[model samples]
Target: MSKYLDCYDYAAIHAQAEHVVKHRKKLRRDVVQKYLDWFDTHCATSKLRFQQAQEVIPGGIEHNLANNHPFPISIDRAEGAYLYDEDGNRYYDLLMAGGPTILGNNYFGKECAQFIIDKAPLTGLYSEYERKLAELVCQYYPSVEMFRMLGSGTEADMIGVRLARAFTKKKEIIRIRGGYHGWSDQFIYNASEAPEDAACLNGIPVECFQSTHCVEPNDIEALEQQFIENEKFGGTAAFVMEAIGQDSGAVPLTREYHAAARELCKKYGALLIFDEVVTAFRLGMGGAQAEFGSKPDLTIFGKIIGGGYPCAGGVGGRREIMEMLAAGINKNRDKKVRVGGTLSANPLTAYAGCLTIEELAKTNAHETLAKASDYFMKEIAGLTEKYDVPALVFNHQSILHIDVAGSQHIPTIYKKDDPEFARQSKEASQCVMEFAMALAAEGTIISGGGKTYLSCATAPLVDEILGSYERVFKGFE
Candidate 1:
């Protein structure tokens, strides 16, 4: 066992965290390594399981975020705000399935689950549940004159790009750097880089990023310049961005930047696409667009909309552009776009989504979750100050990012060569993992990454989480 494990008492944990700055290097290394070993031995089951997973599942995990230091925990089940791994260790779930499950796991009563089962899972045709859910979405988001369902956020964005090109008759796209819009080639360019000219990962063609220009999150001037040059380059089809940056450490664009970008998109005749796969309903009923008072030509939604089911995504916007997806206009001739999956709008997924929307709307779940998140951020901020750690807490309602180091300004979207920025990025990543591992050893889990999500967590649960933070921070002292 590591020395840190000897101090598992909550008071001792808090003392260690209070003096974290004094012993940063040792704590980061020992604490992180200890947790990694624990996860390998207790969480991953055995080397044989990992090997079997690798033989079947390419990367031994379905999603990259599920890959953790010692390998991801194979979750057994979840309820409320807690998850139980296959090893029977309980954890406070802060990952929240990467920002869905606003009502928490197993939120929907068996009635909702049974509803789907009784109605059958898939229809390979339109279902009343899909239509009702779309209408409910439009009820809150009036900007969506029409909506179409898809299998995942990736497909929603993929189809959005196609629609933008068809509507604008333009080829190029302008996306924000470090903003993750899904795995599709167009939006995947320049993601997860320094604040400079960083390229997308391998397997992606250089030509894919050639037409996809990237701009910084808050640089209004740079965005304007991109628009000006886009006109010279025969104009862009769409200016795509996460309404709030998700993968780039939850960085947000100021209201002024968004308004200016909206104007520039109008001036250049480029469609504005808000990739709200993670933001929609998570930020508010109408999402960041409604919260920030900005409107985009197209919006993509995922996560919370699906209600923790496998159901993933959809695109919604003005009728004119969305009409292209109608029977006659689309070239696919199957009364659908050339892009669609058999499970795109399955009845079970649609029922789950609709039920979730209904519950969320009835309980005003967003406001409650936001309050819980605000409490968490405030508590963490207090812990950081008390410990004299150079940490910052950032959140947009229910979603939160704990920057163990200070937040760095990502000036240009695609420029990734700045050494100082790189150093800060690495430190923040290390601090987050280390802190999270320490918390995990104390019997709490907050995603094991730099961020945390709040589900139907109540004030009592928030207090318990804060107590855990207090324990962790006190250890540093």
Candidate 2:
């Protein structure tokens, strides 16, 4: 039998579900009430302040992702791997601003932030920092010959599709199922379960996805079949996808699959685009393409490049295609793509991005961060085994996924005939949610969607985090 099954059976035999419930009961209501009361007396003040702000700020939070259950923790400050909540609650932060802040918050160098604050945020003109950042990015990703900066990953993905259409003179684009390129109209299809048949977000015209196609990851036959059918309908422009499935929980594409994809794109007369917004510097200095040894026609990047700041994204690749931006090919005569934003390549964002990349390169921070992530995965696995819990941890460098009740061991994508496997997988995802809620109450803020990230984390932080997991899991015992 497979090693996964062996591990599962061993855990099943030793598992005591009551241990988890009994410990949970020990920390139940009364115990939680005492802390809640104390928090109310101390922490409720900030909660009130944020609630008042909500009248003007829509959700009382700048980013929807920051708003969490029990109301969001109004963070007073953060340093390294820790966040200081308004109530003086210090907790380990695993979300890391949804996978940015590789060097952690407030570490983007005081000098850089100060310079931007004094000089200005946006100049609406070309700045030296933009050129410097582009140069740095090109040094690492040689495929990016001529690149254009944008405001967010969403914008980059949108513009990337436009560029592909402009270059290839084709309309249709292919995306993998469950891959989230962005909230844009063209590339938003098949992202989630929606009634729209195409999975396109509301407000998007149905025609936007008429040419877009969806394929399952790791399924070479299905991918080729889509290409064959798409060609009959006027050919495909590009195959855009996250090089390392970030939103889908770090589900890596096999080397053979990526290689096959590159060959297929060439065969179909379509451009290949790698959406590296979350995978960029996190996987390595060269990103997923470098790690996987596959070359694509275009690439999109964000997140770590911004160093936790806003307005970070860009598209880069073959000179012939990227130079189209300068060649007046965007169906506009002003020699500019119709897609320029007031804040695209803003001075402040550029400065932060440059400094962040410099730090990442100088210290080899990605390697260290990967080590911390490895430690985290191993410790979590060991803890699950020791506690006889059916939890599994999977990771790629700094990104991680927690699959409670054996979810990690199951294939997320399976053949249609494999109903038994699908049923088991669905149950495992449900179990993950339960364990995640419990972990959150214990003061560790992992992503609500069962994902986590590590940044500038040290060995000591790993030990502390694992200890917390051990304590929390022991309660399950």
Candidate 3:
């Protein structure tokens, strides 16, 4: 087993599901009422704001992270580990801007903004910070020989896939279901465990996904089978996966699995692409690939890379593969595929990223955050045992996950191959939302699914954070 795999205790998680099976009704009644009453009283302004937003915004929220059960919290200001909503409610920002802002919200190199105030923001050209930031990242992630900044993580993955195809002169790419590599047209298609449900592929052309294939993580046989099938076309170009496993490591792939996966990709002449969007800085400076002991041909990064700013991600790897983006490298300059944004590598984002890494190194932020995260994960895991709740809390370093019935442990949570587990999983999902609202009521806001993206800034508030979750779980008993 991978040391990463040993980090969890699924037996305890699976054992707690019986409580959910036994007390579904009571949990629903109490948790729902508790959250509703609290939201009505405390988040009145947020509800009104969401209602108004619904008139214009498609989902009544800017992004899914801001969204909650009935509505989402509207942020007025944030500092360190806390966010203040429009309604004057304060929340412990567990989402941490969806796993970036490692040093905390509004942190852009501390003084970089002041320094850049006099300098031009963007010239649509090169800047010192661009080179400086690239140097900094290349120092931390030794696997990446060269790098290119992009508008978003999605953009990185889009180009990464294109680069893989161009480099190998191959077509098909294998991806893990329930894995996130950005929401590009190629990736959004059937990116879940339930291969039958292509609902997420609604607007994209079905033919666009003809070259993309899905396989569950840890299933080397299925992965190999996909590669075999792809050979009928042009052969596999790359195998892309979140190095920590799918759903941001909610379902972790074992050490042996990763080793086998690396071998499988090599056997079939496919590049191994590690999508480290969430795990880039959250799991440590080296990221999940280091933790899992797998080195891939390419690595995709986002979140903290740009230090919570626009144009905040990139693709990095071998010099030969990355050189495909180099224009002045050879006689045929135009042969290089275009793969950058107008604002990419701008001074401001680079300054932020440079300072972010500097701070992480100087203050030893990763170590502090990891220790607190250890406490938080184990504490939340103990909640199931302590209060007899049906949910399970597990994490990879600072990235947290709570599966209502620990269904993430059942091989694949994407399909209903096991009907009873599926039913309980759905119920537990509802339970998770309620608990999230409950946590919100107590001033801690996590993602809709209860992912607590912790930061070292929140280390001081661990006791209070734990108390908020403990109170909610005990309410169920």
Q: Using TM-score, give the best candidate's number.
A: 3
lDDT of 3 by residue, 203-228 (tens): 77778888888886677788889989
lDDT of 2 by residue, 1-477 (tens): 001211112233123222222222223344344444644665675678688888998878877456554456678888777888877877788878888777777786686768867987676877898899889889899788877778998898988888888888888888887678877776657664231354454577778778888886677899889889988888889998788653733445666778889999999999999999888887788988888888899999876667778888988899888776753234555544456777888888888888988988998898788777777787787776776665435566777755555433333434435775566656555445545545555667676456677888533488877766776666553
Quote each prediction's TM-score.
0.87, 0.84, 0.91
Candidate 3 regions exceeding 4 Å error are 1-5, 8-28, 109-112, 192-197, 326-334, 407-425
Clashing pairs in 3: 2-255
Worst 10 residues of 3 by lDDT: 1-10
Tens digits of per-residue lDDT, candidate 1, 1-477, equal: 012111113233233333332233314455456666776666655344666799888888877666555556677888887888777788887777887778878877586768766776676877787888789888888789888877898889899999898888888898887677777766777665332334454676667767888887667888888888877778889998888664633555667777887998898899999988877887788888997798899999886667878867999999999977854245566534456677877877777888888888899888788777777777777776776554445567777765553323323311345574465556555665667777776667766555577777533488787777766665552
lDDT score of model 3? 0.76
Evaluate model 2: give its lDDT: 0.71
TM-score comparison, 1 vs 2, better candidate: 1
Give candidate 1 regions above 4 Å deviation: 1-30, 33-48, 193-201, 326-337, 406-424, 475-477
RMSD of each: 6.6, 5.4, 3.3
